[model samples]
Target: MAPLMRNRSPNNVPNELNVEYYRQRASAGLIISEATAITEQGQGYSNVPGIYTDEAVEGWQNVTRAVHEAGGKIFCQLQHVGRISHKSLQPFGDPPVAPSAIQAKAKSFVVYSDGTSDFIETSLPRHLKPFEISGIIEDYRRAAARTLEAGFDGVEIHAANGYLIDQFLRSSSNQRTDLYGGPLENRARFMFDIVGCISREIGPGRTAIRLSPVAPSNDVHDERPQALYNYIASQLSAYDLAYVHIVEGATGGDRTYQQGPEPFDYAEMRETYYRTDGSGAWMVNNGYDRPLAIEALEKERADLICFGRPFIANPDLVRRLRINAPLNALDQRTLFGGDAKGYTDYPVLGG
Candidate 1:
């Protein structure tokens, strides 16, 4: 897993494509890099890696080579933070840009030169016009082209976690009445269009996307989570993408609220996207252990499973699962906005 944007360190253990790190966890069928910014304005926090730059592409290419040398497959997650950014994080003190000008209620982690972390309020974004919106789609295409140049197995478009795509998908955030909003199809249009553009840059078989149905992270709420995601899944079915990853629980909220009774169930939600008729592969994430992951795969609910904190604490996660070995616990304090202390220092089993 790629580290969160703001949680990066100057050492760049997580964001940097290091040989040792990828060598350790090369067992995963496919390792998706942490959310990568599509542009400088797409950044949400300090030090989150960008895919738009030649240097960034070179850095990630080193990572891809490392993983590939170790017999591992990897994908880069293309992300745009939308309004979930602080002015301090933007280039030249520019404000964050989004589908709307509203400010996200979430606080981004800010790191200091001393390696300390603090929460900072997100800046209000400048709402994009029709022309600017088209520009953003081009941004995604460029980012996807870079990912292909970097030699990654594929690219996972991060439409989840209250980012740019999510901002347009949710009714609570998108209040526009134009062709880009007001109806479910219009809201999903931006995503589908971006996907189509990116697919042209890279083959559709090498493209993927991640979505969250009921996640209330970053203060995002939808009027109809079920219908919204159902339509999204159905619409996405037209593309011959690699797979779709879904975060099952509230990705950016309290665990209690996420596990509570909600209109959408995680298993049922997975079924919406991963049908047996072979629409595409489906990957399920959030709070999954070996047992739960195996169960999901057994029941055909998920084709692959992504483990976040578990992978952080256990670099040999695939081996641990294969042998049913004991797992390590992650240090929550160092989860975000940290150096390599908890980022790359997590030990492999018996190491």
Candidate 2:
């Protein structure tokens, strides 16, 4: 599994709590925690962690402490789901808001009162105004502040995977005609603003951003991804933040639409952020292995690698890599929005 960081899970776990899980895999140069909702309104799935609560701050503090004790650095990934959420997942049963009123074609995975599973299609999003947009930025800033309070090394703004930020980044999903949409710069303005706010809250050195330029998951489509992302990279460089994480393959779902006579070259897309200013670090995720990770690092394509499923089954992933041990296969059945069955039940190597 490449980009080893999995999506968010419930903050509370058994013996393998957030602290233990992170400490176990502390050998990784950087451990990006699962997607953390910026606010209750930002949450798309039930039981996922939130950075906005006092209890969550304490829980993540334990996680950061454990990773630090094991000599590892950790980054908190901030996620905000806009139209991709159901009323059940929203705050006070409020409808999820987005840049436009468009409803995402995707369904959100949620748990019922009976503990059964179901998928609910997204409802019409409340088209946000300029003032509401400012509130969203504040939400991100507050989450960043809480992350700092939790003792994380840094924060990664989740602007990919068809979430709230991705909705604004993609032209097809974002039909706004205001300064917050339309052109690439305007489309990217919200992200940049968020970066600025978070930087102010936690400092630029401890800030990072994740972007999926070519991956069209969540019905996100842009006429010119290369141009749009190039512009984004160029703009992001001015901030001199921590790093930029890019998801290279088809994120969220299978690839169905054909680009052209040739498939999108991930290497070329990698160059956009890697060469933007040469100041910030670059991380490449999605379907990467040991050899490819080392190659990307050696070729300077990516400074750090993220592994998702591999870490799920092998907590001692760094040690396994050092000893060339085989990794346990991930159980897809228990992947998303589940309990301890696959969350932390995987035994450590030789344990």
Provide C-alpha RMSD values for all models, in order.
2.7, 2.8
lDDT tens digits by residue: candidate 2, 165-210: 8899888888999999998889888988999999999999999888
Which pairs of residues have clashing backbones in candidate 1?
2-34, 7-337
Summarize candidate 1's per-residue lDDT along 234-294 as a digit string, tens digits.
Answer: 7777778888888775874433344224547555555555445676787878878888888
Instruction: Write out the backbone clash pairs for model 2.
Output: 3-306, 3-307, 3-308, 4-306, 4-307, 4-308
Output candidate 1 Cα RMSD.
2.7
**Stretches of model 1 off by over 4 angstroms after superposition:** 1-6, 9-19, 113-115, 252-262, 265-279
The candidate maximizing lDDT is 1
Q: Candidate 1 overall Cα lDDT vs. reference? A: 0.78
| Count of clashes in candidate 1 | 2
